[model samples]
Target: MPKKLIQRFSPKPETLKAHPHLKYFGEILQNPNLWHLNRRSAAGAVAIGLFCAWMPIPFQMLLASLLAMFFCVNLPLSVALVWISNPITMPPLFYGAYRLGASILNEPIREFHFELSFHWLAHAIETIAPALLLGSFILGVISAASGYFMLRILWRINIANKWQRRNKK
Candidate 1:
C-alpha cells in the first residue's frame, strides 16, 4: 500500500498581525530585494560598521550607526555589531590595540592601571595619550575589513543556498 502525503501549513496573516514586532519583522522577511543586495555592498557596510564599532573611540555606537545609515546598510545589524568591543571583550581588544601601536612605534607596551584617586584621570591620560588616536584607527580599520570579508563569504554561501531552494520550489 502507498503512504499518504503530509501537508505542512504556514501561520495565517491574522496571527502574524497580532504581534507588534512581527509587523517590522515581516516587512524585512517579505522584502524581495533583501537577497538581491550586492554581496560587495553588504560586505563593505558590515566591514565599515564593525571596524568603527570596535575602535576605542568614544561614542562608537553612534558613529557606527551613522556610518551604517550613510552607507545604506542594515542599521540594526550594524548597531548590533558594536558589541565587538564591549566590556567583556575590551581587555583583549585594547591589548591588541596597544600591541599594534607598540609594534609600529617600536615602543614597549605601556602598563595601564585604574585608581579612584583625584589624579587618576590625569594619570590615565598620560599613559594612553600617545597611542589612543592612532592605535584605535588602525585596529578599527583592520577589524572592520576582516569582518566585512568574513561576513560576505558566509552571507554568500547562505544566500546561494536560499536561492537554490527558491529555484527548486
Candidate 2:
C-alpha cells in the first residue's frame, strides 16, 4: 500500500475527534494503531472491510469500524472500504450470493418479482434467507482472505523494490 496516499485521503485524527457524534467513542478513537498506515494494519483493515462489505445487513461501515478497532487495524480505511457494496452494486452482489447459496444447498432457484414493500421483503426473506446468508458468509470469508493476503504481498513487494533501488543508489 502507498502509505502516503492513504494517509492523504484518510480523515485526520483531529477531525474525527472533534466530530460531535464521534465524541462518544472518546479515548478509543485515540488508539495509535487505528491511524497507522503500516503493512499489518493496512492488510488487516482490508480484510475487515471486505468481509463486512459482503454482509447482508445495514451499517456495514459500523461493523467494519468495530472490527477494525477490535483488531487494532487502520480504522478509516476499513470503514471506507465497506462502500464497495453501495446502492449501485448491491443488487447484483446479493443476487449472485443468493444463486451461489442455492446451488450449494441444492435448492431450486425461485423466480420472484421485486416489490418495494415490507410484505414483499418479509416473504422474500422467509424463502431465501438461508441460501443468501450462507452464500454471503462464504463470499465474505473468501473476499477477506484474498484481500488480506494480496495487500500483504503487495506491501512486501513494494518494500523490496524500494530496498533494491536504495541499495543501487
Candidate 3:
C-alpha cells in the first residue's frame, strides 16, 4: 500500500523534530496530520515537493517543508522530494526551464558558459532570470498537478486491487 511504502521511506517524526534546523518551526511540527501517510497527505506532499523542486531558490527543501507544514501534508515526503533537484539533476532541469521560458516569452535562447567567478554568475542571472523564473513556475505547476492526480489515481487502484484479492479469498 502507498501508506506503508511511503512510511517505510520517510524519516521518523521524532528524528525530524529533533533536527536543529527543523526545530525552528517549533510546535507546529508537532501536528500529527503533518506526519500521516494517508492519500491526501501523500499526494499533497508529492505536489508540494515537485513544485518546490522546480524552484530556483537556494533552500528548496526548507520551502517544501514549510509548505507541507502549512498544508498539513506528509512533511518528510515533501522535504524528500526536493532532492529531485539536487546537484546532479539541477543543471539539466534548470536549463530546460530556461529554454521553455525563453520560447514562451519570445526571447532568444542564449548559450551559457559556466564560470566559477561571481561576476559571470551575476551577468548570467541578469540575462536569464526572467525566462528561467517563468519557465520554472510553469513547470512547477504542471509537475505538482500531475503528481497530485497521479498519486491519487495510483493509490485508489492499489486499494481496489487489494480489495479484489481479499474478496477472491
Candidate 4:
C-alpha cells in the first residue's frame, strides 16, 4: 500500500497582509462613528468617477479629479476609477451617444465611411461634433448622479450593518 501525504492547512502570513495602505493590517481595529461620513464621500467619488469615465470629453480623468475635489470626495480613488473607460470602449460609447443625441434632436443618424486619411477624420468630426458634445454632457451628468445615489444607499446600509455588528460584540 502507498502512503498518502497530508497537506498543511495553515495560511501564509504574506497572503494575510494584503492591503498595505490600510492602517491596521492584522490588529484589532477600532470601529469609528464617522462611518456615514466616509461612506458618503467614497460613494460620491465612485459615482463621479464612472460618469467621467463614460463621458466622451477629452482629459476626463483630470476633469473627474477636479470635480471630486470640488465635491469633497475621495479624490485618489475617484480619479483611479475613471480609467473604466479606455480606448477599447471609446468607439462604442461615442457611437451610442451620437445615436441618442441624433434621435433626440429629430436628426437622421449619419453613417460614416472610414478612409485611411486625415482628411476623412476631419470630415467625420465636422458631421458629429454637435451631437457628440451634447450627448456626452447629458449622459455624463445622468450616469454620475445615478451612480451617486445608488452608491449612497448601498454604503449607508453597509455602514449600518457594520455599526450594529460592532455594537453587538
Best candidate, TM-score: 2
lDDT of 1 by residue, 1-169 (tens): 0001100132333553456764665554343332223565557656766787657778887787567546666444565568777888887777777777767777777777768886986886666755665677787888787888787778778777889999999
Residue 125 of model 3, lDDT score? 84
For 1-169, candidate 2 gives per-residue lDDT tens digits of 5889888899998998899988899999999999888999999999999999999999898899989989999999999999999999999998999999999999999898999999999999998988999999999999999999999999999999999999999
* lDDT (tens digit, per residue) of candidate 3 on 48-153: 9999999999989889988998999989899999999999999999999999999999999998888999999899889999999999999999999999999999
Model 2 earns a TM-score of: 0.96
Q: Which ranges in model 3 have alpha carbons more than 4 Å from their true place?
A: none
Error of 4 at 47 (Å): 3.1
What is the lDDT, from 0 to 100, of the residue 19 in candidate 4? Answer: 44
Q: How many backbone clashes does candidate 3 have?
A: 0
Better of 3 and 4 by TM-score: 3
Candidate 2 vs candidate 3: the lDDT winner is: 2
The RMSD of every model to the true structure, in order and in angstroms, is: 9.2, 1.0, 1.3, 11.6
Rate residue 9 of model 4 by lDDT: 29
Instruction: Please give each candidate's TM-score.
Output: 0.65, 0.96, 0.94, 0.68
**Residue pairs in candidate 1 whose N, alpha carbon or C atoms collide under 3 angstroms:** none
Clashes, model 4: 0
Worst 10 residues of 2 by lDDT: 1-10
Q: For candidate 4, report its TM-score.
A: 0.68
Q: Give the alpha carbon lDDT tens digit for every residue of 54-108 in model 4.
A: 7777889878866765676655557666887788888888788888888777778
Candidate 4 lDDT for residue 107: 78
Clashing pairs in 2: none
